[model samples]
Target: MVLSYMEGFLLGLGAAVPLGPINILIMNESVKRYKNGVIIGLGAMSSDITYLFLIMFGLMIYVNQPEILNGLSLFGGVFLIYLAYTIYKNRDTKIDIPIQQVAKKSSMKLYLKGYILTSVNPYTVGFWFSVSGYIAGKELNPFITLFGMLSAILLWITLMPYLVHRSRHKISQRVSHWISLVSSIILFGFGIMMFINLFYN
Candidate 1:
């Protein structure tokens, strides 16, 4: 269980460390309003864990049935393209908004946003299912594997906010925009890969 947990945490870190609109939003908020930035990152992180839990709990098995994976792949591809277009269209907008006292949105809302964003990609679900399946196939305990997965999510959510906060200001705005663009391209590539896999398999 300990070994599995460490491996899962490392996997989660690798997945979350990449730059995206969510990360950009976190960074943007952090530079101007520290607390809210943390909140946004927390939201994304929470969402990721929720997806992790869903995958661990056998939701993917159901989703993978009856060509649902194919549907997911198609939807994910379109979603990526739409996200890319939106980002490209708004690439020049200055995002530095002034901070003000406001009612705090529930953490549940943040968690759901993160969860839904992560859940949109069927490939991700498939990947997790494969990992868990491998362990179960090898006769490992499902409960322990779940604990490991949870550990990974905890490590990611706990550290990502601080990392984003620390690094946001060090990079130039142009650089940040470029990073976001690259992230979009990567997402698009994943979408394409998922589409191909859906048909090839």
Candidate 2:
């Protein structure tokens, strides 16, 4: 059980540390306000917890269906495209509008953005399905694995925002602009790729 937990921790880090929509949002928001990023991560984490519960109840098989995955990809792709457009459109906006106050007011919106983004992402769903299937196939302890995964993910959520928040003072206007622009392009590219994959694969 201990060994399984250790392995699960490593797996969790592997899964969460990779470049993904949630990570991008966390990093981008952290540069402006620590709480924004932390809330986003918490929201994303909530969706993951939901899937973990489904897996625990042996309902992940439904999520593995091709049609369901494809449907998620479709929605995710469209939503991502819209977000890209929104970010690019507001590229000229300044961050000096008192982020703490704005964050308090827009807390729900930001949380929903993170939760919706993760929930619609086919990759996120597929990955969880795959991981759960692997554990079941191996006859491993699901509770131990899930506990480790939760711990590692929580660690990431805490540390990542703190680090970015600390360095936010050094980031300049031009750098921030480029970050937004590049993020917009990358998100657009991801959306296009998701669409292309649906037809090709």
Candidate 3:
């Protein structure tokens, strides 16, 4: 069981380590409003935990239903396309908004925004679901595996802000713009793959 938990944790870590839209949003938020940023980060982490729990309990079986999987893929692909545009539009943007202004918004609202943003990412949810199903044969306790995965996700969220904070100086506006552009491209690629997968596989 211990080995199983470790394996699950490592797998989850590998999946979550990739820098995506959520990470970029966290970085931007941290620079502009540290407290709200942390809350948002925590909310995103909470979504991960929810995904992990669903996955551990055999939720991936939904993907085997062709109709459902196709619908999810279509929805996910469209959302990715929209997200790509949003990122592209913000390529030249920086964190200039005051914390006081941000603070006027309720914390719950910020939390919900983060939660919904991460939760709506079907590819991310599907990835965890698939991974959980793959490892289900190990006979490990689901809760233990979930705890491990959540631990790793929380650790990543806690550490990532500091890394972003430190590296901000080295990253110029041009570099940030390029990074957003590249990420948008990557998202577009993923969207294409998902669209193809919806029909081909």
Per-residue accuracy of model 3 over 1-201 as CA lDDT, tens digit each: 787678768876876678775676676655545565667778887887776656556665664466866776887677767767776787786644344564444789668756756776666666776666666777677677766777777777777777776566677777777877886787777667778987887
Residue by residue across 96-162, what tens digits does model 1's lDDT show?
Answer: 3333543354666545444555666664566676776676676655666556655665555556556
Alpha carbon lDDT of each predicted model = 0.59, 0.82, 0.69
The residue-by-residue lDDT of candidate 2 on 1-201, one tens digit each, is: 997798678778877789887788788778778888888888888989988888778888798788988888888889889878877886665665566454442888878878888888888887897888788887878889888888898899889999988886677778888888987898898889889988777
Q: TM-scores, in order shown?
A: 0.65, 0.90, 0.72
| Candidate achieving the largest lDDT | 2
State the displacement of the C-alpha of residue 84, model 1, in Å, after optimal TM-score superposition.
1.7
Q: What's the TM for model 1?
A: 0.65
**What C-alpha lDDT does candidate 3 achieve relative to the native structure?**
0.69
| Candidate 2, superposed: residue stretches over 4 Å from native | 96-105, 137-139
Write out the backbone clash pairs for model 2: none
What TM-score, to 2 decimals, does candidate 2 have? Answer: 0.90
The residue pairs found clashing in candidate 1 are: 47-114, 47-115
Give the winner by TM-score: 2 or 3.
Answer: 2
| Model 3 per-residue lDDT at 64 | 46
Instruction: Please give the lDDT score for candidate 1.
Output: 0.59
